[model samples]
Target chain A: MKHQRKPCSLEHARFLRARKKNLAIVWALRIGLLVLLLGIWELVTAVGWSDPFLTSSPSRIAKTIAGLYSDGSLFYHIGVTLAETLIGFAIAVAAGCLIALALWWSETLRKVLEPYIVVLNALPKIALGPLIIIWFGTGSKAIVFMTVLVGIIVAILHMLNAFIATDKNKILLLRSMGASKLQILLKLVIPSSLASFISMLKIAVGMAWIGSIMGEYIVSRAGLGYLIVYGGQVFKLDLVMSATCILCVLAAGMYFLVVLLEKVLVKNPDS
Target chain B: MKKEMLRFSSVTYIYHTVRGETEATRGLSFTVEEGEFVAVIGPSGCGKSTLLSLAAGLLKPSEGEVTRSGSCGYMLQRDELFPWRTIEKNLYLPLEVSKQNSPELRRRAKDLAVKYGLGEFLQSYPPQLSGGMRQRAALIRTLATDPDLLLLDEPFSALDYQTRLNVTADVAEIIRSEGKTALLITHDISEAISLADRVLVLSGRPARVSYTHELDFGDLKNPLKRRESAGFSGWFEILWKELNQ
Candidate 1:
């Protein structure tokens, strides 16, 4: 409060207005770039510079989406992928934090499991496609399993780093107060590691989407990912392009949700 | 007759690091009597912090015994208030840690916040408060646990000169008003003189008590007032010479 110079209300108002104006300009520019790219793409194919069949234009993708909507498959595919991703994101974050806590609590367990966790993280997850299908069968379960597998290791690593990086001084203060390990973890470690946890969730969102789509690419009867594979097989390039576009929007939407969660959870989020 | 609250008898501490061993303190002995405010002054890196750490049970002495009559509350150089918690919640940390989070204790903590002029800021985060207020809140947090003694480790050194003067006075007043014995480890000669009933000067590395002075500024209450008292600079200069030696 002493450092606060206490700007005049009029000056503060002007500052806020200028910031809002800059934010509006930024959003406009982002949308404008997306529109400009779409326009160029459409123009290239509309003028016959590129083959429309080979390189589907934005209008074609839009038309393909409309066709899927009318047939009621658009929502169905979106719902399938969205459900898998959200479920996987939740499970991975929870399990990851819990496993990290366990690893933190037991130094020996962390030592034994750390190298294996690193190996699993390094392994190409898509290579597990056949084993996953055989174990969970060609269903949403296999896709969900794939999603969890892709994200859990990264979650554990990031969260473990956060838990271990809690301030030594604060830990000492708590210990001096006769705090038990469980109390220390609950009061000090978990609350302070919130930023790391939120960032981990943000990363896991992308991994969940990738895992679900990879699973669908290997074996799936539905989901936008399945549509992409089916469209490729049938040479419906517009369908593939449309499904890919939807995936982009879905991933962005999930990322936006995590950002909002960060805003809600951390009062002073490192923006 | 004053009762003895804490005693560190022939305590020696040796820090073990990758570079080998460095002796911090050796044959260090002192006693804090009930209701007494004692300050220890030494040169920088002369194991002032190590001594407090040993007393707080964060580090054990390599030799000899450290004895205490009751629970002790430790205040660090930095006001380590949890950034995520509001002021009121941060004050509850020790109570929560000790499994003493009763409704009465929470109310008393809130009352202490209000009594200490932090009523309006009880719901604010630590970052939102001034440095002085944060330190006050930290002291209140240490007080909330109702420990038999308080160990303050250069608690006001991080503040600006003006804030440091004001905060030390305020903290000294609070500790005195609460009737708690305190062991303050500081490098400031005047600050050590103003707040403490007795000042102990320790020599550099392999720290042990080199000199002791019993302050007798009768009827001087606050730290600010103590500086205004007669013979304040006399005690300051004497301790200054002792510390520099």
Candidate 2:
């Protein structure tokens, strides 16, 4: 006699519904916190308890953003910054994965080249802004170079660690079954290192933004960073705060994009 | 003598560190017969894993000759299935490695999965399956290459007790049905008594064979039923006493 398994319970359905409700509650709380902070800032300025000139009231920042939007400067600056960040981040990811692969393939090369990488990573990449500007001459190229410099070493280190940390027994098992080295690398090592690589990309997104902004601050005619510098030079605290807010929003947006990519890659990693 | 599926003649292995050397297996010797299910039971740290490693050619014997008639398949303590791969793709791993990626071979691999109760979960990843199903999938992957011998290095040690019994029965059925020889290294005496035709007991580190018991549990073919046989506890006690000695 063949035994048939019982159907799943409605209790499981109820549990899943409750979990979705809890998730909605948490997201609502997060938005509420942001609103509360903004309201407090507006109230403080209206009561004359805080100087709107130095701190730049939320309403003034919003109006400044609206004015820039009406005149099209806001979109232009955003476009410039976004182009620099994406190009630099793409180059960094490619170069970083290639370097990690090279290091993993050769122990002697890794040992010989490791100290140089350490030295390069230790040097403050912000200091390279002047050199990059001199070489690439104050355009997207310099900003991209700076972003790659800031982000590549961290990506290489993380990916190499992930490759080396794969299960040794599985590798041995494959080898014992007469698998070639390339087969082991492709079938076992790379797939296992994917979660780590996605995490490194998230970190690189933030570092790339930092590098781009720092480059702009040192030597650009236009960008969010340039707007901040221009506002400071002309003593318009409102413009400076508005640019800072834009940068924050852009960075948060990129971080969330990477988080979405990670969700797709690992497909429910740790929930 | 079934052409001596594997022969290890006077093999000795030593673990060397900066401080010194510690011997794990001192001039141990054994042979596995073709299509035979052999279980190796020993005390803790008695180099059971070392023996499997040597047989798999992962480690060369320090002092003796180790020869195998055909290719080997090794299953580890953990399932070691890649989380990113679907069950069907995982089953094709060995075929992929051996450059046997033919459509017929892939179809046969799928048939094996279907026959082993993984038909519905062919597209599922390792994380989506239960522990026993994962183990079954792993075994199917191991058998996909049709290797001459299987080296099981405590494959059930990671499973809970109930899952262990169920998986053990499934594995025994699979090996017998597929007509493959297997060498299982286990610390559990009853496990050895129930699943294996012959149980080889070894001493503590620097291990050597202390006793070899041939078991017969009547007409019973199922592992659980074999465990219920009258002679089950008797063989277990004998193995326990031999391990203690």
Candidate 3:
């Protein structure tokens, strides 16, 4: 049996090896491109080809980040922004799902509010910054509210479409068994939308960051967004670059965490 | 005489949409007795699905009554298994929904799966199973509650010809052995003739029973045998003409 398997098994092994090699090559190229872009920026700045004052070399950004680290204020700003963003994301997701469920529960309510929802979604959120400041004041409360405001609409729209798009046959099957509307929602609707839910989370993560930073841009005292604003006002280009870099890393980290959640929560990710 | 399991008395259903109200079924009357397998055949879009929905009580009749003796288990065209759930969990869904979930019922459900050759696949997700296997799991899930009536909505229509025949045989044997009353809606004349004890042909849209035939394949209770019997094609020809006319 072992001898008979040798020929085809070797071919299978070769195919697997080629797949692994292709994946490695793809990842290597991704990293290599990032490193190459940074190297060129640094080389051009160091050689006086571009004004380092305006562009801010990678080395200068690194130095500014180290300074923030030594001063022990690095984590504080990160914590403030991260906490606000996470809290806003959670509230928006929860409240949005509830609102979507209510809308799905009543055709009358959905029809009545459909135009208003579309209008709210279309309106530029930043235009309401002054009103938000007036309502919540210039505190973390305002920033968190802004984050929720940005994320919740997206969550509601995404989840509502998913809820409405649930398989009609599955709903019929459940209904035939005497399952209540609530039961259908719990057993079929919610469970079937895990993929959409994860995708919504991915979008909400971006919206949460946008809302927080946008709020900070309006009236923030301390955050990466605050640092970016203050650094710009003071003409400290290195600080601005460092804060932007930190925001990128934090956003990527949060996105990866959502992806990780998709892996754990959705048993059949492909489906 | 077997007790009456389901009765549809002058049932009429109209679907209201933004465009207009369309009458789907009109003055449709039928009765399904306990322990009998009844099949409904009609042209496409002839309100066959509307009839099942009415029977399942998912929709109320527009102008008449749909009365059933007990609860129903519904199987659809596609398997409609929740891909996120294991076969075992999917089978238990009806029990959970009906508030009849218990250790004994779950065990019984599991035993049914094992009996029907899904023992090894119980831990597997629906996506992991073959199409035929998924449909079988769906039938088992329907039977989990031991419903008084089983409403099958073109349950074999999704499978390819080969798998459809095998699964049809399996489903017929299972239903017969369980002695469950079944109402199957299909457009396939051969399928209607092979499986049902009594076959009801429906008119085109605004459907009502146009003709009803009692199959006579004496002692050929198995679907595959019923198909091989001499009377199978004769009944099929009759249903075909009735359906076309």
- What is candidate 1's local distance difference test score? 0.92
Query: Which window of ten consecutive residues has the lowest lDDT sum in model 3 chain B?
Result: B217-226
lDDT score for residue A182 of model 1: 91
- Residues B82-176 of candidate 1 have per-residue lDDT tens digits of 99888989999888889899999989988988998999998888998889999999999999988999999999999999999999989988899
lDDT of 3 by residue, A48-128 (tens): 999999999999999999999999999999998898889998999999999998998888999999999999899889999
Candidate 1: deviation at residue B40, Å? 1.2
Per-model TM-score of chain A alone?
0.93, 0.91, 0.95
Off by more than 4 A, model 2: A1-29, A269-271, B216-221
| Sequence-dependent TM-score of model 2 | 0.90
Task: Categorize the docking of model 3.
Answer: medium
Q: Tell me, by TM-score, which candidate is best.
A: 3
TM-score of each: 0.92, 0.90, 0.95
Candidate RMSDs in Å, in order, are 3.3, 4.0, 2.9
**Which scores greater on lDDT, model 2 or model 3?**
3
Please give the lDDT score at residue B155 for candidate 3.
96
Residue lDDT tens for model 2, B1-245: 47688888988999999999988898788889998889999989888998998998989988988999998888988888888788888899889899988999899889989998999999988889888999899899988887899999888989999999999999999988998999999998888887898889998989988778778764565789888888888998888988998
